[model samples]
Target: MKTIALTVATAALGTDAFADSSLPGMTGTDHVGFTVPSVDEAVTFSQDVIGCNVFYPLGPFSGGDSTWMADHLNVDAKAEIPTMQLVRCGYGANFEIFEYTAPDQDTKLPRNSDIGGHHIAFYTTDMDGAVSYLQDKGIEVLGNPTTMTDGPSAGETWVYFLAPWGMQLELVSYPDGKAYEAEYDERLWDPRP
Candidate 1:
């Protein structure tokens, strides 16, 4: 694990990059979308265990055998995105899950070091109870919970776990708040109850 350092200078936004005019009064995250091997299983896990509620379902969408989708979404134009479901995951952003049948789709889960590899982390009030519950339900927890010893994340405890389909997930808890939060007037949204 790496200890991320945050300083006033490091936190300043850089002005050298090409900047588009910001969207006026822009809101926060709308959703985080990801492709899944099976949307049905993803939905079941999210709803039954993760406590998300289905927003809606969409698709069987294609680009009508043309290059429209290839140019826009970078998918094969003839590919079929069989299903898409939006689900609200607690007080955080929604998840847009997809099931696609494409000519060049890769089903293997990527390592965190691989480009675009990522994991979704949920905050909890009790790390031990949460880990125990997931284990009893047969989910693969990678290791025991680790408590951060220093830096902004000190006092936090977290552990990585795997979904049934092998997509990585994490559970973190810091009921007393993190070291960095004390410096800010407003804190970021925490999933803890």
Candidate 2:
């Protein structure tokens, strides 16, 4: 597997990204978090549009209102912390939704290059076919599905796309999974209590 260059950030601290996650039974690191504007809207898109399942619901009592943690615990009684909806891919992998009560403006994940937040990847048995279905639904396809001829994912194929609110997603078909294995390492994403 050929190594592809991935950017690594330098600063480190007890920020939200640095907060020690109390996710149960997890010993490795958590990669990223997704911040959205509304839990209800996020639920609609993820369930109706993305074809995922609700794994768990997150409220401030559970995960805390960082960005996706919408209403402050004291601000909105029902919304003590922001509400988080965890959605699962058809195959079983999960992506979480975080909708904080922020302005409906683009904050960080505007371009495809921001490397801090979460980017959910869905595994599709057929790559091109999946891309066509999404595009037909009026979703924004980020160019074409590129079959990697270089790097560890050399034989793997990926097509990038964005959710209506600008959350990034990927449709992927791996002819061989060596690259993904190396990258993800079978890491369990949810460990928080």
Which candidate should be chosen as best, given TM-score against the real structure? 1
Best by lDDT: 1
lDDT tens digits by residue: candidate 2, 12-131: 322344245576544333323466767788778878877767667867553243532334332332333257777765544356667655334345665555555556777787787888
List the candidates' TM-scores in order: 0.84, 0.60
lDDT of each: 0.83, 0.62
lDDT of 1 by residue, 22-113 (tens): 86544346799988899999999999887889889999788886888889888888778889999987667889999988888888989899
* Ten contiguous residues with the weakest lDDT in model 1: 1-10
